[model samples]
Target: MNSSQTEWAEAEFSRGWRLILASAFGVGFGSIGFVTYSIGAFVDPLGREFGWTRTEVQGAIAFGVGLGGFLAPIVGYMIDRHGGRKIALWGLVGVAVGYLMASASQGSLGYFYLAYAAVALLGAGSGPVSWTRAVAGHFHGRRGLALALTLSGTGMAAIFVPPYAVFVVENCGWRVGYMALALLPMVALALAVFFFFPDRSSPGGAAPVHARTLTGFTLREAVSSYRFWLLLASILAMYIGITGIVPNLIPALTDKGFTPTVAASIQSGYGISLIIARLGIGWLLDRFWGPGVAAVTLTSPVVACLILMGEPSYATALLASVLVGASAGAELDLLAYFTARYFGMRNYGRIYGLLYMGVALGAGLGPISFAYLSQISGSYTASFQVALALFAFGGMSILFLGRYPRGDFGHEARPA
Candidate 1:
């Protein structure tokens, strides 16, 4: 081929790959951020339908997360060995089927439990570990922002899912809510089959077939490293602080004397902050160490939680909610990006898979966890105080990450 023809063909291939990747990104948007995110909104409906207590309904949510956490290591190992396409595609199948099952659950708690277990299995397949590893394989230079943009599915989900779920469940019934969720995975599956790059990248920049398992470090090697443990600690601290307060935000604010409507509105405001922060964090990640970006984003919650403590008025609650939302919003991106950078994308799935279990674990404990703190004192006020402390500790811990890990994905390491 002539130079011009070769150049044209290369450009065409890049465009096709970009489309594939973007489509995969959308699939991810629906899978991780949308499906999992909308669970909380359905809790009330489940309670009403089954005559279950709030605590009982909360137990189911915890069960799903715990199940997901338990499954993470296996899922990560699968992705690391096989490439993300198959696992993620299969995940979509699970989600679609799970939602369908949940829709049929009606008043049966057993059915609800079974359906959510499927959803949790699906979650293990497509969650942060799977998608982040995909982005990590594709780019090293812009990996942080790349991870952020794809993971922004959560930001989009926070923006879109709740109100939609509320409208469906309030007017139509909870079953319809499940039916609506069923469609999301079809999108994921289509993209996975046609687009997800199912290979570890080649040095020549050509795509290759899914290959046999090549471990980055033996299980022994990983456990011996201090870095791995530190990263794990950071992940746990982050999830506990963010998920703990958020699940209870509406009640916490209402207890502080805000009306339920106002409390709900505060969550919306928080979502807006999170969306804005997500875009800003994505831009920043391209230029800075993810940990540096995390340091700023994580500490944001400390200020907000402290403000929350004052209960100065409803206004403080509103402001605090947004700050917390923004912090929580950007957090998964930080963890994902850091995993890719610190460890290398070669084994990103297995490494991050274990790390993401922290999120699952923290989520499982979010309700009972903070309640214990509240019990230790008197009320939500004291419990939130402990949350704020953890947030601060988590924020400061990012500083210990030292400089960001470096590599040549494509772009220069633009200074933040």
Candidate 2:
């Protein structure tokens, strides 16, 4: 093997990857474990126990996740100023407290709302902004793979959390489930951040100049750049498309004649695909043209939408889930990578914070939009068509990014 290729290989598997991967696990529990993955389980129990309507239980999600979108920029700023380690520790504490609040719910809808909003607002630190920043700063030559391994944590959560929560609730009860969710973030995540995670900058100190150069854009420059806006547009479209289909995945499959159990099994492909896409796409980005990889990955969802619009079958449903999950996985990897590539890391926390709003907004809106479409048309065909068009638009826009920034394309060579 060539000397440079060997160096790159060594760096890719270095010990640092383990640390970042561990941090990713902590970040995943903070996000997917307690928040996204666990919420569905909460819905049924909350409904049965308190007689809360589905809409009311779901509204708590909207309140927490939507308002958190507004606070993302603030969290990013804190990450930039305070460093990821500190922010992550604080965020884990907030997550634990939020779930404790959920566990203590006394049948008040207002109290439920408060519980959710508290998590989103205070737990923003444990989100992508904090965890990803540390990984991004540490790895350069193999940044793509490093980030991929880190993000695989969310995929892990998707696979693990749903069944785990079910097992807990089935045996103990919902309050116990909430308490279990809190412990991972409070004890595990806290320990991970303190013992393993490293900060790019010393606590309360300035970032190294080279790190700033690598990040490229300041907060103002990032907001004003056409490329930034383009990326945001793409992010929004992809999220809207994926989330639109995912919420209705079971029903959509059932409509196609699959049994409920089979339909649920097909949905598992999404989580599996998520892990594969992150690693495969990350590997490709390091070798190929970056934007080209994004454009192709994002465009695959259009085919998934088309399949959903066609005749029903087990094979077709599984294919659609895999394709959609691939695109969904690429969303954050590209978002995190491109943000650092285009803008400098000096303000990465804030810029990424603003960009993640797309994630929040689309996830919140996508499901509702799909439901509205199904309600109106009495079928999912119309929603699939709309999503297909948006995915295409979003994919094509990546071409406008032109190329990776100067010095960004495999320029550095460092171990660990």
Candidate 3:
């Protein structure tokens, strides 16, 4: 609140901005960004090529990402034992390999699903679990803003990957599109992360001495807390709602008579709003009640669900997309912020990793479930109705978190 405090926060950014930028790039091109965001662009192509139905095509996500979610706790434990930099670097390489495997998929849908699963399992470290751990370690004063900046990479991926994938799939075929996605993490993100993200646990890595003294609950202690379970339940519901809508958005719009390009453009609106939400909500988290902020931000998407349920104009569709994007944007930010505040950095990687599994599982389920609902009901309306309920439930559930534990640096302890 004081000028000195403000300056200190600013100083944290000055010292750690490279780490933030690296993290952003890693997250954007990593599993959540390239793998998750680009699936929509590939859905129609993959379906047509393999004679797969919508649910079948979307099922790749369920088998791939859902099963991969089981690895989060393991990845988290590794990061806690070692450091994120090495894990992230190797994960990016594995993600590139996964994309190549997807590109090489034959007519076998099982093979395609396995390829995606490989991507999720191999690239697990490249997700928020590793990146946010490093970022959390580096910035305490402006932690919220730092995390927002880091995670806005997903928004960036949302903005670029769909259209890019669509453009590539349209011109060069879907195989080439997957190959193109591979290049992202292989070249640019890998270079950025290797150069900028330092391993604090490694010799000669040059972390602040005080970082070694950071404190928090162990994995067992964190798991025992009621707040941990509450956070997991809320995360699962919120991600299920948003992720179900996102990859399905382009197809749903195209079915409603929008052109593929137009649908992709509308999805861009979602990405733009996501970026806005990350930055704006990040700022708010530092100064406001995080649960209250999450409650309002996540719940606003109910209106988006309502908008999409009816036939709407392009502008309305865009509005709905933006609202959904906004909610998606807030989900990871809240997850990372809440995990650090409630549990502490002692077991941050493992705690956040377990929580990230909820995100991964929800993401995996959302698309397949949405596609299944659409297949049965002949429209996205049923899915939207279900998602609307989920958004409300997830948003409201954050209110039950009560308060942050005392003595967590950078977060004020509220009265119990």
Which one is best on lDDT? Answer: 3
lDDT of 1: 0.65
For candidate 1, lDDT tens digit of each residue in 245-283?
765665566567765445556666666777678778877
lDDT string for model 3 (1-416, tens) is 77777776776777787788888889888766656678888888888888888888888887657766778889888887777677777888878988899999999988998888888888877877888887887777778888999999999989998899999999999999999999988764556746766555443232542357667888888889899899999999998898899889999999999998999999999989999999999999999989999999999899999999999899999999999999988999999999988888777888898988899899899999999999999999999999999999999999999877787643322222
Please say which candidate is ahead in lDDT: 1 or 3: 3
Which residue runs does candidate 1 get wrong by more than 4 Å?
1-36, 106-110, 187-219, 254-265, 310-315, 371-379, 404-416
lDDT by residue for model 2 (244-346), tens: 7765665566677875447656666776898899999899877888789999999998889888998847787789988987987788888888887777566
Which stretches in model 2 have alpha-carbon errors above 4 Å?
1-15, 32-34, 48-55, 170-173, 190-195, 198-215, 248-264, 309-315, 372-382, 408-416
Best by TM-score: 3
Candidate 2 local lDDT, residue 138: 61
Instruction: Name model 3 segments beyond 4 Å from true.
Output: 193-195, 198-211, 409-416
